[model samples]
Target: MVNTSFALSSTTRRRLSLVIGAYTVVVFATIVALGVLSATASDHAPRDAWVHAIIVAVFAILLPMRLRAASRGSLAGLRAIGIISGVLFMVNVVESTLSMFPVWMRTEMIVIALLMLVSIGLVVRERL
Candidate 1:
């Protein structure tokens, strides 16, 4: 019985780790793609470009930390990051849509919003 319990616990840990790892990889890839798209654009507004760069940087920094938190079964830290990212993403979307931003800036905003939504979904799923 003890052996069975230990095995089950170990399996759960491994599964959690895999989920976190996958999430991190996806987030990092999305951020990098957005960053590249933003950096290469010629007609972006200065404000929009700055915002895009900042959001991408934040995601780049936070993805690994989020994975670590998830691996440790700490949902609070992930949730906090998700909420902040989501809010910033929404703000960027609104700004890019209403402002006279370039196509690349608009696309980058959309990408960031999607990334934030994915993070929120992952964190919620983990809680449930």
Candidate 2:
């Protein structure tokens, strides 16, 4: 049923949702582990680390809600999130590729870009 309407089949949607979910989990674990280490070891908080952690933490809460909306067949919501996340990831990928980030970081960016591109594909698939 999902496949008929979107580029992503139900299985693919489920898998991608799981991937996003896992990514969120990793975000939290990184924060907690880093936070604990920083608390015990550092006299002052690292501004950059805290900012990055907080941002990813927000994604931890938001992405699942968006995925739920998307999985529930909300076309408008899906399109909005899909396009926004897709373009954001695409831009990040290009930026990372051109930046001085190491090969591994660029590779990770590419992977995330692929996932978001699939999401965008699903959004556009509705019209095809």
Pick the lDDT winner. 2
Question: Which pairs, if any, clash in model 2?
Answer: none
Kindly list the per-residue Cα lDDT of model 2 for residues 10-119, writing each as its tens digit: 86567657667656666677577557757785433354445645765676677678767767766655666666666656665765555444343345456656656665
TM-score of 2: 0.61
Candidate 2: misplaced stretches above 4 Å? 1-8, 43-45, 87-128
Each candidate's TM vs. the true structure?
0.57, 0.61
* Residue pairs in collision within model 1: none
Residue 85 CA error for candidate 1 (Å)? 3.4
